[model samples]
Target: MSSWFEERRADKVADAEEQRRTRAFEAELRREERRKDRDEERADKAQARRDKALRKQARAARREKTLTPGNVYRKGTLLLVAMSALAAIPAQVAYFVKKSLMLLPVPFALEGAAWVMAAGVAYADERKLPAWVRWLLRAFCLSAAGFAARINYIHGSEQGALVGWGLAAVTMLGPLYFEVRQWVITLSAAISNPRQQAEERARRKHDRRRRRHHRDVAKVADRLVSAAPYGTLKPEEAWARAWAIVHGTTEPGMTPRMHAWAVKSAAALATAQQPLPLDSKTIRTRIEGRLHASAFVLPTASGTPLGMTKSAQVVTDLPPASKTREKTPVKPARRQPPAHRRSKGDALPFHPIAKTVAADTARKVTAVNGHH
Candidate 1:
């Protein structure tokens, strides 16, 4: 019986220890799951923060790009014009409503006419219509506005002095504001920058001067421009071609005849300035003549005359005439005829000095050969 009790107690202790280990394992698994959930939540929060920062940066960049001075002015002016129109309509409606139900259309028509004409002015600017058309639209807009203002003034005057002025002011302000905006848009479109305006002015002035100076060429250019297909030929190109045709030269301010005259004059001046060529024989003859002339003395008060000097008389240390003999002149070797003689058309032209230099070189070669 004692052995039986001891075995039962051992079994009970093993079961309790197993149950405790199982419970501890379950608790560890739950802690791991909670840790995983906390990590996922942190990651989500980080991603959300990054996305929000990116959106904020994008919004700022968009605003920076969109907000410009011109955009602000244009959009603000339109808003103001809209506000003016809204404010002025109530006054007109109130005045016209008391007169007659049929006359309710009159106030709308008056206000509508002014706004329509104002819009017409903007349309004219967009279509690049004539200045007079824009001015006409402006006039119509002002006329309608003026008529509306008169009606408003008359109607409000029956109420009070301050009310009359206030109604008239609001009635006129819409059209006037829109007209000024249209003017601004037109001027901005026509002249974007002061520098561009000045450049356009200068270009026009230069074109006028050129046309005045070259009337004939200008007429020909104009004719050519008129004859060509529209937008096919530029005025400058036409002018260039016409100048070439009229002057017979591609270069402006010069003609073929003028160029020929200039060349001829230059050649003549060069020839006039050039020294004459001297042959070897002429050079020797001139030297000998100078020596002979120096030997003679002119008759002075204390000296003998040149004609009375004798050949035999030893005037100084000069050698006797009998001992001196004239040097035999060496003739240059004759150049062989070329197999094919070049004609004037085939020959290349050279400077005039080249021929004189060739002759001198031949004479020198001959003289050297004779001495050798």
Candidate 2:
């Protein structure tokens, strides 16, 4: 009986173990399904984010393409800050003249036109056109209406209206001349700066001279200095030899015993070379100057003076022409009478303001002849 009971207990234990394994397996499968669903969700989100970013970038690019210089994009960009405070007086005069329109029928008509145009724009405010276009159109229409109203007012009143309107126009627009002058000055400064122009001119001159120098120097001497035949030599010796050949001078390896190195060293000691910077702005500015100087016009077969070709081989043979001298005639010196041996003719008496200049001259001549 004990053996049978033990067998039953083992079977029960086996059955419980089987049920636990089944539950664990189902849980694992359910967890895998949840993970798979999560991964799919993440992928979908990433795709959606990419699509959104692409759309935004496209919109920004489209906006940029619509920008134009003559439009409102450039209108308020003008800097007139320097014309402040001091210009307020004129602004006040403008305001006063604008206000005084009530005193004159012609001025009143212009003011009425302004109000009508403003009302027109106000009524159309709900229209969804671009803000810049609206502002530009309104400015144009308003200016036109004001002009027409002014003309019509003058036509109606005849001779008297003509005089009063002309006077009023001058008074009203008089301050605008200063405003125009300020605009002119601002535009001039914004367009080109004098300091920048001067610097550019200087840079162009330097580049032209430097380019020619480089072109000349690019053709090194037929033979570089060699220390093989001679003793140990410095780099200066090499430069000296090259310089002599280029300059068409016999000074190379000549007396005063200038080691090619010493001459080069002395020169290096005397002059200073500024370092070329890596910044792009500086480089661009320098390039602009060089282009402006290009008009100075170098004589070259190649479009660019720096270009090298077969003709460069015979470059030494074609030395640059030296400036010519013209023989100028020498003028002879004029002989002058001695101050001690004064002639009555040479000395004229001073006269008072009351004496007519012509009479004074005649008297002086008579006095001189009498004394002689």
Candidate 3:
């Protein structure tokens, strides 16, 4: 009985183990099925997206082909564009000018027109289109709508004619929004206020000349500073002086403009200070010897005109007043007429003795003339 009972227990244990194994295997199979379903779903989604994109591209291509010249698409698109613009322009103008909402169709009409124009341009061979049509197409595109919206926002922020801009925005849509804006404003200003336009042009020209002069001065300063010995003047000093001389301005200090100027000057000075070849001395010597034969001896070293070391000390030690005096021409003082000489109308304002002397000299001159 005991042995039978033990055998039953062993069989029961084996059955429990088999059942657990079966459950685990089924669970694994279910997991694999779930994973496969997920993978299939993802693949289907991706394929659907690709298919949608391909369909969209195909539709665009077909639309473009239809929009080609001599096709019905061209005529339809142009008509739609013209009708939309005609309707939208008036409505927008009225709404903006009068603040009337009765022209609610304005935005919608313009948007539709822009979309149509963009699509037509995308599809058509622009070369076959008339210049005005091409211009219209480019001026009314998807990007133009965004640009117009931006302009409206800008006008609203500036507290300017928001309504005017809002109405103008309808026609202002263009891929070349900035360029169109610039040219249109320029043209309008040229027509409306020519004096202002001329002034603006002159100002721009002056600015350009000033900038050119500044750059030229900076370059010359770089050369001057490089050739000048390091101790003679700081690069900044040289640059400042150069700027003042060139621009005829007494403004001092290293300004934002001088930052780059100084950097270039330093670079030039570095290059100038670079060591020369050993043969340079021999070459210089030979040149000097030849010059000596012509009674013109060259200095062994490049030095200042005063034969002094180039330093701030040298400049400070020298008398600038003396130098100026040497350069300035002196006029000889005019000799005063002799007190004894006198003309018929002449008399000394002061000194009675001078008056007597003049009278005596006059009598003597008369006696000489009589003798002659």
The clash count of every prediction, one per candidate, is 0, 4, 1
Deviation of model 3 at 351, angstroms: 99
lDDT of 2 at 80: 30
TM-scores of the candidates are: 0.56, 0.24, 0.21
Kindly list the per-residue Cα lDDT of model 3 for residues 1-372, writing each as its tens digit: 999999999999999999999999999999999999999999999999999999999999999888775355335545544553553355444445465566556556555656666656544432355657756676666554554454344435455676546534544433233334334444454469778778999998975675475686768677888898878977667777787776666574445567679899999999999986434344546444643344312122235333223231212223344433455677885995454544554431323443554465556556545743
- Candidate 1 per-residue lDDT, tens place, 264-289, comes to 99999999999865556666565446
Whichever of 1 and 3 has more lDDT, that candidate is: 1
Q: lDDT of model 3 at residue 256?
A: 56
> Which residue pairs in model 1 clash with each other?
none
- The TM-score between candidate 1 and the true structure equals 0.56
Which residue pairs in candidate 2 collide?
236-260, 236-261, 237-260, 237-261
Q: What is the lDDT of residue 358 in candidate 1?
A: 54
What residue runs in model 2 are displaced by over 4 Å at the alpha carbon? 68-372
Top-down lDDT ranking: 1, 3, 2
